[model samples]
Target: MSAMEGDSFTLRTGLPEIQRDDEIEWRFGSSRTRLTRIAVGNITTCNDETFRDRLQLERQTGDLTVTNITNEHTGVYQLSIIIRNKKSTKRFAVTVYAPVPIPVIFSDTSQCALSAERSSRIFLCSVVNVSHVTLSWYKGNSLLSSISVSDLSISLSLPLEVEYQEKNTYSCVVNNPVSTQTRHLDIDQLCQIDCDLCFDSPEAVIRLVVSALISVAAVAAVVLLVNDIRRFGRTQTMKR
Candidate 1:
């Protein structure tokens, strides 16, 4: 009467041992990464049912093989072993998460549509598949403030202040447990049209006045020439 048990001498708690040139197949990635290590219990001793002879029980460590892991290889896995006409099995679980991608910020700072008075221009932050992401604004590499987005998406309105608008490099860092992504926003001064100098200056006013005077003089001269020709024709007709 031989009884096989997880403990007492038939199976030991440890990694499987393999001989030279022996094929050891370690399966992983049913739902997660491969196994790094495994723990097993001591062996259990037992007697055969025939009772003709004493069946010596010996626990052996099973051989394990590892392969390179990838993102798609995420899932539960199991380890199986066969010893002396008996089979045993164990189970493990795994989880894989995606890394965060780089964060991009878009701002409306062109001169065509200027920001409203006393209001900041809107800047949008966009990240893909980063649910519940935390967005932190920074000047250079130093952290300024962190804000949590309740939804997957949110827009940040950045007022063009004297200090911040002049900064050379403004950055946004987005992070999660899996990964962190950062992006830099360059704030440049809008190419402006100086209305006081270019449009409403002394030179511009003088040019406008000269153009109006030339137009009036041309019209008056044309009118007087037409009247003089008509009066000369009438006097010649009376003489004839």
Candidate 2:
């Protein structure tokens, strides 16, 4: 079983109620060092640096629980019970993982326009410093793409391609056993214009418009000057 850091977990023995005469003991780690013991209506807990003030045992049953679990507390645990001089042991394997981080979605076209081609816009979803998690892209309720990793301390990324005028809905989701996070992609915000030279920001659009007007005015002035020169030359030739 797996659990996130700082979370609580329980190790169930599935045994019946404890008897006063029965003896119970719990051991932890690879070396199987003693963690806690119960015998003759008395409970004795290990004061090891790893489990101090974090271990609990049910007095009625032999079930064990640990709170505020950390990576150091991850290991194999053993429970030994002696009933009528017969010893029975059970072992549990536990794994600890860091909490999943909130995923961030990025796009190369955040301030660009989209073309008719399907690959004109590319979106990337990423999460960093997470382990034992899955990152996925969803279009509405449909799953688009997903990547899963086990116990790896690295970032994960998933890419999605969006086409012009073909938007349904899109989102990125990152999740682990303990937590889940989601981010939605707004197509309108990403592709403000859908032309060859689309402007991302309103200020950029304004500048483009102003530049175009200036160019038109310059062209008009040049045309008028050429016309005036041609007319003057004709008059001079006639006069001569």
Candidate 3:
């Protein structure tokens, strides 16, 4: 069984009911420390400091629930049941994983436009403050690259290079044992190479727009002036 940290997880007993004369015990962790036990109509939970006030053992069905679970609570859990003096054992493997963060896709060339030397535009897929997760890049449902980390997987950013005219779908995904998050690529938005960047500054862009607008205004003024001159000439000819 797998669960996310801070969420409650339950281990089902799979029994319809527990008889009044049965003995049940649940132990957890690497040391197999005794956590809770029920015997002949009596229930008791041991103070295993790590799981204090978090272990709930159902009296009717012998189900065990761990509340507000954390990464520390991930391990093997053992359930022991004794009925009619016959002992039966069942074991459960529980893993608590951190919440997977949404992967981010951004153009690596944002700081500078692509140069003539660069054959392909670069984009990066990244995640932050995450652990125990695999980060992968997919091109049209096909896996291109993947990287995983043992503890902190935030360093597992993946990079991809493609042509400026790339039209194929791409996505980045970050996943753990229990959760996943994905981000899709927008080629037009992230992989674009604006020729206007050749001007090199925001002021240059403003100047270009202003110059085009002035040219349009000058053309319109010239057309109006020519019309007025023709109208005046027509009035003089009619008076003659």
Candidate 4:
């Protein structure tokens, strides 16, 4: 079944026809006093469809599509088939739940290390409008773990660590009584490498400073070469 932005879901059923003189009714609510909604298939028989009646057992038949279904629409739907005055019923239950939202990623930092250097990413998937909760962690599309934290206000933390910091995606899913939420955490090890590769050695500050100056000079020379080529192209274009 697929759901849309609105609180709607469509059910595709395999059963097409019910025996003659039989009726189908959708029932819901665990408690009898809870007030449930019933949308019967409005059964009618014979070729002309003349046996249809709102009440009384006049033999019902037909296919129906129920729309605008709400939470109260959830419950047991039974098909009562009557043949030769003998009746048999079959029932199915439905539960309505909202779609899970995208989670928010919160972390103080986004770096980690493998051999000589290290980085760490912290994340928590916060969700609302839920009662009992279950949390799951994922690496890319694969499931890592699933845990239950019944209280809604409780928080779930996921820590990601790796060797030789690189780009990795971490996902967390939060499922509750009312809805579900998911969030992703991304850590770039290449950036951490940039941090390490761009820094100076404490023991040799003078040499580090000289090395830094040389690197800047090299970058500037490359930029100047590119600019000179662009200027030469423009000059040739003007002459042409």
Model 1, 163-239: lDDT tens per residue? 32354566778875445778776544222221111222355458668888999999999999999999999999999
TM-score of 2: 0.77
Score every model by TM-score. Answer: 0.38, 0.77, 0.76, 0.48
Greater-lDDT candidate between 1 and 4: 4
Positional deviation of residue 154's Cα in model 4 after best superposition, in angstroms: 6.8
Supply every candidate's count of residue pairs whose N, Cα or C atoms clash at under 3 angstroms: 25, 0, 0, 16
| Model 3 agreement with the true structure over 37-57: per-residue lDDT tens digits | 989888999988889999998
Estimate candidate 4's alpha-carbon lDDT, on a 0 to 1 scale. Answer: 0.48
Q: Write the per-residue lDDT of candidate 4 for residues 34-114, one digit (tens) a residue.
A: 111222434332221211221222222332333445444556544444445675655556555445556565433323222
Tell me the whole-model lDDT of each prediction, alpha carbons only: 0.46, 0.83, 0.84, 0.48
lDDT of 2 by residue, 1-240 (tens): 788889889998787798999999999988888988889979999889888899999988989999999999889999999988899999999988777777887776433654323435777899988778899999999998999988668889999887745668899999987778999988767655333256544565787899899999999999999999999999999999
Best by TM-score: 2
Instruction: For residue 78, give model 3's deviation from the true position in Å.
Output: 1.2
Ranking by lDDT: 3, 2, 4, 1
Off by over 4 Å in 1: 1-72, 78-93, 109-116, 119-122, 131-134, 145-164, 189-240
RMSD values, in order shown: 16.9, 9.0, 7.4, 10.6
